[model samples]
Target chain A: MENTALEKSVLNKRKTKSLILRFMVWLCGILTVGILAYILLFILVRGIPNINMEFLFGEYNSDSLSAFSSIVTTVEMIVISLIIAVPVGVFCAIYLHEYAKRGNKAVKVIRLAVDTLAGIPSIVYGLFGMIFFVNILGLRASVLSGVLTISIMILPVIISSSEEAIKSVPDMYREGSLGLGATRLRTVFSIVLPTAMPGILSGVILAIGRIVGETAALIFTSGTNVLENPTLDLMASQRTLAIHMYMLASEGLPYSKDMAFATGAILIIIVFIVNFAATKLAGRIGGLSNGK
Target chain B: MESIKKSKFNDTVMQSVFFMSAFVSVLAVIAISLFLFLRGIPAIAEIGFMDFVFSEKWGPVNTPASYGILSMIVGSIYVTAGAIVIGVPVGLMCAVFLAEFCPEGIYKIVKPAVNLLAGIPSIIYGFFGMQIVVPFVRDNVGGNGYSILSASIILGIMILPTIISISESSIRAVPESYKEGSFGLGATKEETIFKVVVPAAKSGVLTAIILGIGRAVGETMAVVMVAGNAVMPLDKIALLKPIRTLTTNIVTEMSYASGLHESSLIATGVVLFVFIVILNASLSLIKFRSSRN
Candidate 1:
């Protein structure tokens, strides 16, 4: 009788533990969903109403914080930064994956450095840019400084992604080109690069997303003034959408609050679009690699 | 013969180009380190290390200036702890749910939502926190709204994406045979998942939490917007009191700061950098051990 009673108690304990875990699982899942829904809805509802034509295309009026010039600066920075970052990042990735010998100390050092760079805070990048580029390089507080800083910031993302892409290409492709008596340079450019193009493109796209949303790094390098000079000149201080929103929020202008929200909404939408495209590209590449 | 020579020359050129590209990352890292330390160390020496770290007062503009980072250090620790407490359980469960329980249709929606959270910029997060979270706190708990609690909530939300994705992948990567073994022993599905799969993914879970901590500690803009940027230590256990963190201390003052004050802020960045380095080293150590296993 005593053994039976003990067994019953043990069974009850097991049941109670299982029930609690199950409840936790359901509760946490629901909370995640709820919080995500609330944030999305809060931003969209508050921001979408303020995004009129004037906000999108209006002239830069400092008092109002219209985002047109900010948007323009965002696009220009993206272009300039990408121009500098892509070729270099892609080539670096290729050297690591294809050319560098395994177990090489220099290669290991480079990898560690890149990883360290990746983990540093964005604000640190701002500090470094403020000191190195703006002060030391005599670039001053201009778009050029911002572009260089952001390019370095995004370099790790580009290199890591491109390296993975290049590594995924089967060795048989390289071997076949070599067997056909093609030079290594011709084989990589003509045969390997085309195969890895989709993946590289996706990496570049993600870099664009990062460049557009970046703020702290841009805070000092890019300067705060939203320029309406309507030029691609890199010397002028310019504000991207993210910085514009930050400036508005901190300065406590009652009228410009909605404008900040509106810029934020647009920024989110752009990031969402870029991320979607990236995942789709990555998925297609995954499918292709599996098929091979 | 001429063509062969030409091909060899082209190969050399391309290899050098790629090598130079690879060298740039290393160059940038060296440059950053030299600049940060070269400029940061002198400030500490001039200001006195003990005074810089221990003094509770921060008055750079005063006639007799004082630079103490103890409060901000405590504040960073407090807010990060709060974030981990609030974020970890929910993030882990959500990860488990995603890996084990979600229906395909629901998974589709949930997955993208998490990704979008990551994709959204911190500045946008700050706006949301400022407009929504800050006010909501004021209405409910009532401490001027921008407080440690506010920073914690925003940061906790910010970290969810990192926690969920990493943990989900790690959980899914657990060998199927382990689960089957647990099931054959007459354990329930929840029991097997909790007992078997979670333990197998333990290191990965730790990595996720660490990564989340690193993110929460380093986060600046969102925290700045909601944290209220008070430069004093909390006298009591109050989440509603505003506090300053290391990253925010640097960004807020760096705009106008000059001379020793500027270097002190950079010195603060030095401290932040050291914290991140420690976190990264621990992460890589875990990774190294796991790979060895």
Candidate 2:
């Protein structure tokens, strides 16, 4: 009888301990979600009121603090950086997956370089950009300098994602193409690339998201100069939307805070759209690859 | 015969093209290191290596000007340590919740929320810190709004998605047989998790923590806004006092900095670069060992 009573008490203690741990787990999960919700709502609620049509499309001046020029600059940055980074990144992925022999010294060197690139902090990239692109190369704080810097920064992102997409291509596709007398180049172009396009494009979209949001790297290279009239000149030093919001906030003018909040709201919306599109595309890649 | 030969030549050419493309990243890495060292080493030599790195004074405009970064280095370490303390436990618990305890319906909501958190830009995080966290700290805590405490909280929040996603994936990767074996030994679910499953995923969890450290230390725009940009003396450094990190030190002065001041800022970049390289090497080591196991 005494032994049975002791056993029952031990069981109760174990139950209580498990219950407490489970409660802590739930609490932490809730806390994570709660913080995200708070920041999102806080920005959107205060910012939505300040974003008028004029704020989005009007000329940027000391008075209105419009964002139309910055919007143009952001788009240009994305397009230019993608144009340079995507082809190189995709080709690098193809070489790693299809061309290089396993355990090759060159392959190891390339892999290390890619890994190193990925691990580098953005501020370091900024410093490098300032020194190499701006001063040595004489690009002089132009969009071209910034674009070159950002292109290098996003190369790893593009290469890794494209490599995964390329790796997922079924071996049978290559075999069947070769069996039917297609050349190696022909098979890769017609068979592998077409199938991997969706996945590669999804990666490109993610890189676009990175380019759109980048600030630190661009600050020293591209600069925060706002163009009174938006233009496509690569030589012009212009600020993106993120930089605009940062400048407005840091300037500490009386009205700049409201404008900064509005600009931030716009940025959040763009990011949400980009994130949604990438997720959808990534999901489609799995389906298309597996369904075949 | 001619067609096959011609096609073979085409393939060779294309392969060379791809190889050159792969070499670009390698070239970029070399270029970055070379430029940083070349620009930075001269300044470090000029400042006297020991005085530059270990001394506390950072006055750039004084008659003779002193350029020491010991305080900024300390500031970086303190904020990173604070971030690790605050972010790791919460992130680990959340990971456990998602991997083991979350229902399918809740996972859908939580997963997207975490993704959105990762997608948010650092600039926006900085702005949010400027508006919300800094003010909150000033009112509730002892010192001014902009202090080490505020930067830590923001960074801790910022690193959450990184730690959670990495940890959750590694936890899920733990083989089912391990959990089943623990259960068969009469271990309850919670006990099995903390004692058996988490221990099994130890290397992966360590990787998550290290990556979180990398992010916290390298973070710039957000830390600048909340860290008050004041170069505090080493003895004066406190949680509630304004402090400058290695990253913030460069940015706060880079604009107006001229001559040696500019070079000194680049030297600061060189120091930050070394820290990242060390972190990266350790990460690779962990990955290599785990893969071998």
Best by DockQ: 2
Per-residue lDDT of B215-272 in model 1, one digit per residue for the tens? Answer: 8999998899999898974464378988999999998898889999999999998888
* Candidate 2: tens digits of C-alpha lDDT, residues B90-169: 99999999999999999988988888898888988999999999999999987888999999999999999999999999
Q: Residue B145 of model 1: what lDDT? A: 96
Question: Candidate 1 clashing pairs?
Answer: none
For model 2, name the residue pairs that clash. Answer: none
- Could you give the CAPRI-style class of model 2? high
lDDT of 1 by residue, A208-245 (tens): 98898899899999898876544578899888889988
Look at candidate 2 and tell me the lDDT of residue B97. 97
lDDT winner among the candidates?
A: 2
What TM-score would every model get versus the actual structure?
Answer: 0.97, 0.98
